[model samples]
Target: MRKKALKAAFPHTLPVMAGYLFLGIGFGILLESKGFSFLWAFFMSVIIYAGSMQYAGIDLLAAGASPLYTAMMTLIIQIRHLFYGLSLIEKYKSAGKKKPLLIHELTDETYSLVCSCEPPKDVDPSLFYLFISMLDHSYWIIGCTLGALLGSLFTFNTAGIDFVMTALFIVIFTNQWLEQKDHRPAVIGVACSAVCLVLFGPDRFIIPAMISIALILTVFRRSLEKEASDHEDP
Candidate 1:
């Protein structure tokens, strides 16, 4: 069952693997250039797993930022995960023993894949999701390790590499848009985020945007579900 699940999951993760490898490599090179070792890259990628936050974390660690500040920054940056968790609550509720690990491993890429892909009927859904998460995580760790090793041995400019993540998000968003018949959620998210960005400025906009999105979705939950049901029926 697990083997079948893994086989089914791997193909779905190929795109994520490509993105993570390059982004992870960029992170590792940046960290190495800052005098950290491959160990740091490996551990951070394995443990933190928040791609953007981890990149931002390099500066925080280097500056010896206060723990409180670090905590706050991490929360603000990762606030969207709260929404992801909310969406997956029902799907993950019955995962039993796998629930904890699934929650722990729920990075943005993992969340996107899990939300978008369903396991083949022959494969166990839990195992398929687990394997997808594991594969993506492993790709990141390997990429970071390689980049750190190369950086330590040689020198190269890694500027503009972080755009990989932005590109990945754009791709994911586009795919989601194309796949869905109802554009309400996407439109709400973009409109709210743009409004917040203008009103609160970049550094302070995420929380407000997230709040607006959550509230709007919660209020319209019944209608959205009905729309989805209607779409599926026809």
Candidate 2:
């Protein structure tokens, strides 16, 4: 069962594997350039695992930011995961002992794949999701470790490497938009973000945009689900 689930999950994660590897390497290079060791890269990839937050953390660590500030920044940057968790509450509820790991490993790429992909008839859905998460996590760990080793061994230009993450996100968003018949969620997110961007400027808009997206999605959940189901029908 596990083997079958793994086979089914791997194809779905190929895109994520490519993205995470590049992004992870970029992160490692950036962190190493900041004077941290490869061990720091390996451990941070394992423990932190939040891509954007980890990138932000390089600066925080360099500046020796206060714990309170770190905690607040961590919350602000990662608060989107709260919404991701809410969406998966039902799908993951029956995962039993694996639920905790699933939640911990749920990065944006993992969430996008697991939320959209269904297991084969012969595969257990929970195991499929687990394998997907595990595979993606491993790719990131390996990539970060490799990058750190390379950084230690050689010198290379590191400018503009951080943009890898933004590029990955654009790919994921484009893929999701193409796959889903219901574009309301995407439209709502963009509209809210645009409005918030205009009202609050870039730095202050993130929280407000997320809040608006969550509330609007909640209020229209039933209708959106119904529309999604209708589109799925033959």
Candidate 3:
């Protein structure tokens, strides 16, 4: 079951593997540039498993941030995972022992892939999801480790490399938009985010945007579902 799940899950993760390798390398190189070694990258990648947070953490650690401050920062950055967990609650309820690992490894890439891709017939859904999570996690760890090793040997400017993360997210969003016929949720999210961005500014926008989006969706869940049903029927 595990081997079959691994094989079936590999193709689905190719895109994430590519993106994570590059992003992970960028993070590793950045950390290396800050005087940390490959060991730091490896451990952080393995433990944190949060690409963006790890990148941000390099600076925080460098600055000698307090533990309390670090905790708050991590919560703010990863607040989206709360929503991810909510969505997958039912799907993961019966995963037994694997449920803990699944939740721990639920990175954005893994969530997107698992939420969108179903396990093939004959493959256990839990195992397939586990493999997807594990594979993506491994790619990130390897990429960061390789990058740290290479960072010391090569010295090049890395000014715009961070943009790769942003680009990956845009690509993901675009793909999701294209795949879904009911654009209401997407439109609401984008519009609300834009309004919040303008109102709260970039530094303070995310929380408000998330709150507004959640509230709006919750309040109108019935209508939205009905509208979606109407669209499919029509």
Candidate 4:
């Protein structure tokens, strides 16, 4: 049954495995270029475990960015998790003392796996889900360590690896576009980000755009739900 559950969970790992390898490798190379070692990359991936934020973390760590800044930005980036947590509280309640840490491990891929799932009667679904999350995370640590070693040993240009993130996002957007019932949030997010970039300049737009988009979605959440409902009814 564990093996069956693992098999069931494997397909869901594809996006994370692919995205994290590319992003992790890019992060590893960048960290190596900044004089950090392969061991450092492995350790960060093990301890930190955030994907996009880890990319930004290089700047934070290197610049000695304030703890207040780290706290604030982490809140902003992960605020959507509040809603995810609220919904999952019941499903995850039995996690005992592990509850808090499990909540912390809830990433884009992990949440997608949980939310998009139906619990099986014969298998312990939560344990299987948790195993998948841990495995995906371990792969990241390995990838980062490998990439750092590769970077140190090789002399190839890694400039193009920057697109690793962009390409991953594009793939995510495309996947959600296909399977997602309500496209408005995704549409709005892209539109808002593009508009903000044009108006606020690339460096200053991301947080502001995310904030504005989040506000609009929050205020009109019912309307978005209604829109999804109307489409379903039709």
Higher-TM-score candidate among 3 and 4? 3
lDDT digits (tens) for residues 84-185 of candidate 3: 899899988889999989988999889988888889999999999999999999999998998898966656775676565566567778887898888879
lDDT of 2 by residue, 86-138 (tens): 88988998899999889889998899888778899988788999999999999
| lDDT scores in order | 0.87, 0.87, 0.87, 0.75
lDDT tens readout by residue for model 4, 1-234: 778777777776776787677677878988888778888899888887777777777777777899999888777666656656867878887867656667767876667667665656776767767766776787688778887889655466655764644664576678778888788898888898899999989667877777778888989899998887887885
Model 4: per-residue Cα lDDT at residue 225? 80
Candidate 2 lands at a TM-score of 0.86
Model 4 residue 201 CA deviation in Å: 2.9
lDDT of 3 at 16: 83
Model 1 TM-score is 0.89
Q: Please list the residue runs of candidate 2 whose C-alpha ends up more than 4 Å from where it truly belongs after superposition.
A: 152-181, 219-234
- lDDT for position 28 in model 3: 85
Question: All candidates' TM-scores?
Answer: 0.89, 0.86, 0.89, 0.71
Give the Cα-based TM-score of candidate 3 against the true structure: 0.89
Pick the TM-score winner. Answer: 1
Better of 1 and 4 by TM-score: 1
lDDT of 1 by residue, 89-192 (tens): 88887788898888888998899889888899998788888899889989989888888888555456656755656676788899999999999999999999
Which 10 residues in a row give candidate 1 its minimum summed lDDT? 151-160
